[model samples]
Target: MSKITVLVVDDHPLLREGLIKILSLDDDLEVVGEAGDGETGIKLVHECRPQVVLMDINLPKINGIQACKVIKEQYPETQVIVLTVYEEEKLVLDIVRAGANGYLLKDVEPNTLVQAIKDAVCGKAPLHPKIAGKVLHQFGQMAKALDMNNGPLLTNREQEIVRLMAKGATNRSIAKELFISEKTVKNHITNIFKKLEVGDRTEAVIKAMEKKII
Candidate 1:
């Protein structure tokens, strides 16, 4: 089998080297490049076309969130896994919105980090337990708020779509997960927007949280 090419982007030289060393031990993975900042990371991504990127959120120049956004926009096929020490809810949400495939804390077990890279390549989102818990807690709070507010009741399917949207899943990913066509996902989103009195996905998510529709 072919190796999964990877790029390591972090500001710390020691951490970057350590990651490369760890990933190198996995026969199925190859560290093809490294960058110390977000700008260079993007440049290396374009140059190397790695299948996976291990990115640090607090990088110099553009910062990892912006780099992830640009990389995903320019090369949707490339998967980015954020490796950082931050466990803040807002940062987690921002990284997801920027199209990161996974979020792992800096202290993650070596084996778990390796597996996260593999999972990302398989189109699976791997979020740190703390980060995932925060997202789930937020969702749960929204559900409870919806109950208390007596907001417009959404169908089970619509609620599912809204939940997925809040998790930052693309329409394509949502369709695949729901076993429906992309067109169907779009239609559902349209109905959801109308019901929630929102415009786009971001606005819909905000409104859903504010109104507790999801």
Candidate 2:
């Protein structure tokens, strides 16, 4: 079996070392590289071509959000998971918009962290429970403030898919739950994005909430 390659990117040396140690314990995970800031992290990512990256949002140069955007734009195959202390709704939304595959708080347990990395590599959006709750709450508030009657109405299937997406379900899991193929799920999601006028799952959920479609 092949191991998942990971790049640890955080400004704190001790935290970086600790994360590397924790990730190294899992036989299926390999810590291929480390970087102290977002800039170097991007550089290492290009060099090492790791499948997954554990990134800190608060970096000295070109914060994680920017780095994530660049990485995704340049190498969409590489998945990024934001590992940060901040759970602010704005930061979470920003990271999501920047194309991070997952968001985990710094206080996450070692086991959960490892699972998150694995999940990200499998195309799952592993958002911390607290962060996910906050995002949902924010979206709900925005929805309440908007006029729901004005936007495009989603079909029952699309609405269901968006609800699962809000809960951080991956395409595979969504397919399993809905009793459909992953390809069908992808097709539905593409339609959902078009109707919602959003680019990704996070934005789709936000838009769905804003339009009260889910």
Candidate 3:
């Protein structure tokens, strides 16, 4: 496979420089460019056409979430991994909704950061363990908040699915535990998304919790 091209975006010069240095040690990866702000990052991304972008959430001109949305919209093939200090569920959820493929806390080990970059390049939703709980709780809260009228009016079976989803169960596991087919699970998810007005599982769970439907 070709080397993965990466772009670093952060307002802090030291952080960007450190990341570049860390990534430089990886022979399989290449740092294509760097930017000091979100807008500049977006422009560099378009110009550099990097396969992956290590983006910081706090930036000068535009916020990282907005930058992620712009980059993802214009370059669907480019994957973004948020490298931030924020561990709040709301922030993580917002970033994911904006199209980030992965999230890593700022204090992550060098090796882990390298692994996360590789994972993001390979289409995996890599998340720091410390932040994973927050993400999962966000999903649970979403499942708990749903009410019948506004959220997806889940059937008893679908409700079961939502419950497992809130607990962070994958579709295959849900299928195995519930004795249902994966296709059936997917169909339910589609209906769930339509009913809840959500595009992804995390959002669906959040909406469900908001309405107390699940």
Best by lDDT: 2
Clashing pairs in 1: none
Residues 1-214, model 2: lDDT tens digits: 9999999999999999999999999999999999998899999999999999999999988899999999988988888999999988999988888888889999999999999988877767898999989877887788788886978998999889988987778899999999999999999999999988877776687677778888
Candidate rank order under TM-score: 2, 3, 1
Candidate 1 residue-wise lDDT, 1-214, digit = tens = 9999999999999999999999999999999999999999999999999999999999999999999999988998899999999988888878877878788999899999999899777656788888889866766665765655666667899889888876768788999999999999999989988887764565566567656765
- State the weakest 10-residue window (summed lDDT) of model 1: 198-207
RMSD of model 3 against the true structure: 4.2
Please, what are the lDDT tens digits per residue for candidate 3 over residues 1-214? 6888999999999888999999999998999999999999999998999999999998999999999999988987788999999988888989988978788999999999888888666545678887788876776666555544764467888888888876657678889999999899999989888888876665666667777776
RMSD of 1: 5.0
User: Which ten-residue region of model 3 has the weakest summed lDDT?
Assistant: 143-152
C-alpha-based local distance difference test score of model 2: 0.89
In terms of TM-score, the best-performing candidate is 2
Give the per-residue Cα lDDT of candidate 2 at 53: 91
Q: Model 3, 101: alpha-carbon shift in Å?
A: 1.1
User: Please, what is the whole-model Cα lDDT of each candidate in the order they appear?
Assistant: 0.86, 0.89, 0.84
Query: lDDT at 64 for candidate 3?
Result: 99
TM-score, each model? 0.71, 0.89, 0.73
